[model samples]
Target: MAEQHAAGAEGIHPTNDPGTPGGSVDPQSGADSAAPTRRARRGGSRKSQKATGGWGAVREIAIVVVLALLIAFVAKTFLIRGYYIPSGSMEQTLELDDRIFVNVLGARTGHIDRGDIVVFDDTQGWLPEAPAARTNPVRQGLEFVGLLPDSSQQALVKRVIGVGGDHVTCCDASGKVSVNGKALDEPYLYPGAAPSDFPFDVTVPEGKFFVLGDHRNASADSRYHIETGTQFVSEQDVVGTAFVTAWPLDRFRFLHNPEDVFADVPAPARP
Candidate 1:
């Protein structure tokens, strides 16, 4: 009886033991069953992250674009503006269609001076009436941001020959223009173009400027308009001084004021 009981006990195995051949179940075996489910969940999570990342990238792109346009708008509004040369009045120095940057801040702050090339409004009716312009929305928007040139024809560009109370006279004895009794050797005059085809003597009124084009013969600037009483451009009408030629890559250069031309000219005598 003892032998029979011992053999029966040895054959029996705990139901939860994994090492026994006849065990009912093992806790470690459940891990293998759950692995596929965990793997599937991990794959699903990776896909969700990838989808979210795509939208995040688009949001980043949108932010960059908005920031760029805002910067352009701000810079264009208060700092500088762009304009294209529409005529040959300023030729050689600025060709037709040459894009330029104007210093709006300087003009607004009354930083104007003699020998500076400037753009001014046609408030005195210097330009003939222009037909209404047909504008493209895209082009207009670009112009607003200063990415495209300003196409308005109501402005003119010329060098400031006389400012405020200066006495400006043309064709002194040696065929040169004089300012405040000092002879002007204008090397920037268009080849073979006389300083003035006709004589002119005028004292620029206070808060005004006497302007002239480099192409003297072809331009009807302050010189030609003197008799009409529209010769002087009001300081309030000036848009800005052109600081640089910005487009047509090869022509890019700083448009500096003619320092030497006005250097020795004496200031207007006090009244």
Candidate 2:
């Protein structure tokens, strides 16, 4: 009997073992016996990595754009600025639709002198309330970013004729404007245009300037503003001196102030 029992145990099939491959199982069980497939896990990992890389590229591009915009903003606000000439007020020297660059830094450090072509705000109600120009969203964005000139601001450009307590008179016998009792040799005046169509003598007040345009006939400058009780522009209202013509590459040139024009004019008489 002992021999028979030992023989029976040794004869048992290996398939009956639960730990062996192809072992018998309970088919009604709900749980899955196999772990996840390697191929599925690898595919999921690749998708996750690709998604992360795409976002990283987008983040880097955004940072670069922001930095560029900041630099442009600071430059426009403090270092330099651009202006568009909408009218022929500064014609021959700066024509209609001409673009110019102003030296804001020079204005901050140096002084506004006679014969300087300057850009000034329309403070003291010098300009009438004109309708704003229509601009699309893209143009507006470009202007704000300093890539385009801001034409919406009511600014004027003219040469400084006299400054601060100087006596200025128009048509001093020789058809030339005189400053501080001395006549100016204005070669930049428009061809065949008289020094003044009307005669006037006035002393520029302290902290103000008398400005005139090269296109004398077309410009409604200080000569016209006298009746408005604001004949001169405040020194503080000056945005900057225009130093260069930037647009229309064929017309590019430095806007040099003819210092010798004012060389002989005597200083303003002492108070």
Candidate 3:
């Protein structure tokens, strides 16, 4: 009977002992199985963490690049700009091939004044060339991106001769132009060229302006437009008043309004 019972026990299979040596399970075998399972779980957790951190770093980098591009676009649109002179109309003040920086912000708020050398679109009346080269669609699009060609395509730089409502006339007895019946003693006029040799008497239209160049003889400015059959450049045509000479390191200077003479000129009486 005892031999039969032992034989029966040997035939029965051990149900849950995967780490057993010979089917008779030991506590050490179970402990060994636990170790491998714990190790695998730890390894998987570490790999997941490393992948998550790497992706997070990549996402941050992409966001920074996008922000930088947006800022560049905004600045190119309306704050400041670079301009290139393509003509010698403003010679001795601005030269050909000269790259200049313009402040578009200040001009937007009516801060432009007399004697300021301004850059404006010559689409209508100011361009000297025949078949005037106005701002074409392509150039207009490029202007927004700050990538316009390094040449003025129907743009000009000239000083504001008379503002909104000043009566401007040329060549007084002393050969000086007068604003509001007062002689303008201009110190910046080109050497040896009178304020204006040609004669003109016009009241500046409301919300309009009269502009001229410092270099009189060489410049074909308001005087020429009046002499020729072209409309005067109104304030609507003025782009922005120039405030600086940003070319030829030696000629750089701040262009302040020539206020000493016009300061005393009383505002024209309302008609």
Candidate 4:
């Protein structure tokens, strides 16, 4: 008997053929499919990275621009400013070359007291012949930004002598101007000028102010209007007080409201 062949000798019963997968694809196609899937995943990752990098650059540029704008706005609003003197009105105290800085917040916050030098609008005709006197809408707008030169029309700076109702009589027996019956010893008065040469006896009206120049002889201030009995500047006309001589390092100085005088004076009675 020829070594009896095994009954089911076809070997293992033909496995479910993982390579054929229900007669769909061949073995090589399976390998080809995996290659494309990996390539597509890599391409998507590279595109995502590029998009992220582009947006990052844009965000950086936007941040820089925003910072620059913020800095400019802050400087314009609350920091150092420049102004030009338009006339001889505030001479000796503020000359033509003098560029000054004003403490606007202080003035608004009641830091401006008597004898504090101030800059304001001359719309009330304080300096009738000032170059900035006529139709100066452009100059007036620049005044708000502090960009215009000092000589701009419709602006002036003076000393606060009388606020509200105070008998602001001039040329007292001592040649001193009296406020509410007390005489002010003005040391800042210009040499050769005695308080005021032209006599004024009017009591400053309520809600109005009496301002004069440090250089009374040259200034056409309230005294000029008083001499003519024409126009007087009201307190509302005050823009803000000048507190510093900012430019020309040689002339740099801080202004103080003569402590010795205002200290003795009493507060004004409420109306």
Best by lDDT: 1
Give all candidate RMSDs, comma-separated. Answer: 10.4, 10.3, 9.8, 12.4
For residue 103, give model 4's deviation from the true position in Å: 1.0
Which scores better on lDDT, 3 or 4?
Answer: 3
Query: What is the C-alpha lDDT profile of model 2 across 1-271, one tens digit per residue?
Result: 3333543676533343356332233356632222233345577889999999999999999999999988887787677888888888788899998889998776777578999999998877777876878899988987897877665767889999999989999888898899999998888888888878998888989888999999999999999988768889887788899999989899899999999999999999978
Task: List the candidates ranked by lDDT, beginning with the highest.
Answer: 1, 2, 3, 4
1-271: candidate 4 lDDT, tens digit per residue: 1111221343223323555321223356444333444467689889999999999999999999777656644554555444556566666677766778776566555555677777777776654574434537766655444454445446778888877666677777888887776788877776667788777776767666688887888887787776666445665566677877777778888877776775566666556
Candidate 2 deviant stretches above 4 angstroms: 1-48, 132-152
| Candidate 3 lDDT score at position 12 | 44
- lDDT by residue for model 3 (1-271), tens: 3333553677644435655422333466544333444567688889999999999999999998667656655665567666777777666667777777777776776776666777777766565575644787777656545666324546778888777778889778988898888888888776677777688887777776688887787788877776564535655555566667677787777767778857877778678
Give the clashing pairs for model 2. none
Q: By summed lDDT, which 10 consecutive residues of candidate 3 come out lowest?
A: 17-26
Q: What TM-score, over all chains together, does every model reach?
A: 0.78, 0.78, 0.69, 0.65
Q: List where candidate 4 sits over 4 angstroms from the true fold.
A: 1-81, 128-153, 227-231, 266-271
lDDT scores of the candidates, listed in order: 0.85, 0.83, 0.70, 0.67
Clashing pairs in 4: 84-149, 84-150, 84-151, 85-150, 86-151, 132-153
Lowest summed lDDT across 10 adjacent residues in model 1 is found at 17-26
User: What does the lDDT come to for candidate 3?
Assistant: 0.70
